[model samples]
Target: MVYTISAPPHKKQRITFSSINRAKILTLLPVSLISIYFFGLPALGILLAGILAAVATEYGIQMIFKQDVTIKDGHAAMIGLMLALLTPPEAPLWLPVVGSFIAISIGKHAFGGIGSYIFNPVLVAWVFIRSAWSDPMTPLSIPHIGQFSDLLLEPGAGLLVGVSPIALLAGLYLIYKRYVEWRVPLLFFLTVFFFNQIIAFVSEIVTLVQEGVLNPLLYLATMFTFLELTEELSFAMVGVVIFGIIFLATDSPTTPVTKQGRLIYGVVCGLLVSIYGLFGNYVDGTLYGIFLANGVASFVEARTIPASFSQESVLERSYNRVMEKIPSALKFEVISDD
Candidate 1:
């Protein structure tokens, strides 16, 4: 008699590759439709090009390497969709194809595929496209439709997702579905806001000092007012922080695992955003910031993970040394039973 055996994972997992990918596609599809409606044929063409290129590239690579084909898993399609969303509407049709190829071939597979990429594949493609063809990738002009229509659809400029409020709703849905942790987005927003306020305050203080004004309360009031006005005028900033926070920066494998490490990772990404967006004057600062943060995620996890029982001996030795430093009168010795 023989016993049939199965691979590990005898326990069921609540989250899975298909589930996560499906959730993302569900949310991204609406945004894609909205973008197509607003941007017209060019937008649709880019999306199709990106998705097709990504799928074909993945299929070809898997076949060549004799690996199991996973293109049907929707991960490749999701990457393509995301890359299309980040692309400018005026970008050439060939642009998306090139970007998708890089995303699937180099960014995804080169690092060991699906879960092993360090940077967000979409952003990786965008960086290369932006660097190589800065002229064609320039931001397109968005038509402003005043009044109630603005609430439903506000077309500002830049990337497709950058101009859509629908992206925010999709991000919220992703959070509700538990596909992403709320902490990272929360910390990221708080950090961006905190830094913005600080910068505003410092600027106001310098102006007050130059003007020889003595009333500090007046300066505080002025700074707060200015910040409020700035927030209203710079509504486009939402897409930068929210889109990156909810999707790009929160990739499970590329981000920190433990709670404390995630918090730290969030803060690090936030600071980088502040630095690049505010000081450096970069348009895609949010993407770049999150990409850089991915590099440091492993370090954060290494430091924040709790010491296992195997390392307790080292901790015990340290404790014993501390105890030895105390005087015999102050130290309590363990009495052994003979």
Candidate 2:
């Protein structure tokens, strides 16, 4: 006689709303704290105002549309707060509030809420604000440890613009532990770094004999790698790399679902950013490049590949499809998975 005991079927773990919200708040808090410490109360105030505006806007939109408000999702409001912190301190408080409204009401909701937006909401707001008010967006003064004299001692002193490292690291850690791909950030930063080095080399050669000529590439690289790369003030390049990989590139709605598609998407964003920096006069071109790439990725996804295809084939098919769609356009394709 043979007897066997049957085990119960596995049940999926449900993440409660409270846990999700708590996690979001914890993720955002580190950046907020760092911003307050370095940039002082004004930056903190802007962040708070943006969060309030984002939450209010999201609620109002949900009410009007008769949809469930996912303030618990924490993405919309957090994006707004991040956008606000990224802006220059002297920016009018109203701009960030407006940006929050634009980000949620138009960028996120108008496209079909959370996962529907074709671009990063924070990037959308940043581009809008920068275009609308170019002057005030530029850094006017360096953030210091409560002393103006420090500016004289520090060579790279400038008001830190962009996300804090601590916040970025925490956010990325959570995201990566959830199994998000790391390639997006790696490709993006590597592309930027490579192009930046080229720009630096050329500029250095051009200005070798000139006196007091500051290297724009070095300055910009430092800024991009430090503040723009992460969510808080820290020296860990890993945080920057992780943020770019997970947060910037793993935008599920905007990014391609396939690994190959994502790699292409990341590469395009990196190239566009490099081009923007090399040619465009705007300082915030990286954000714009990402926004544009997001749109392109979405368009490519909707038209290019069949749902049943393998990831590699889908990427190959997308390349052919894109080429077919625009004969005159340059064609870029993935040759191998490795």
Off by over 4 Å in 2: 1-25, 141-167, 198-246, 280-283, 299-338
Global Cα lDDT for candidate 1: 0.78
Put down candidate 1 lDDT per residue, 1-338, tens digits, no spaces.
Answer: 99968997574548778788888888877778888888899889989999999999999999999999998788999899888888888888999999999999988999989778887788788889888998887675532324334535666646777556545567677788788887787787778777877776777788888888898558678656654645533422455556787888888878888888889888998899878877553347788888888889999887778777667544476788898898999866799999
TM-scores, all models, native as reference: 0.83, 0.67
Q: Write the per-residue lDDT of candidate 2 for residues 229-308, one digit (tens) a residue.
A: 23221111322233444465666677887666667777887788668756752234556667778878965555434556
Cα distance off (Å), candidate 2, residue 37: 0.9
Q: What's the residue-level lDDT of 131 in candidate 1? A: 88
* Cand. 2 Cα-lDDT: 0.62
The top-ranked prediction according to TM-score is 1
Considering every candidate listed, which one attains the maximal lDDT? 1
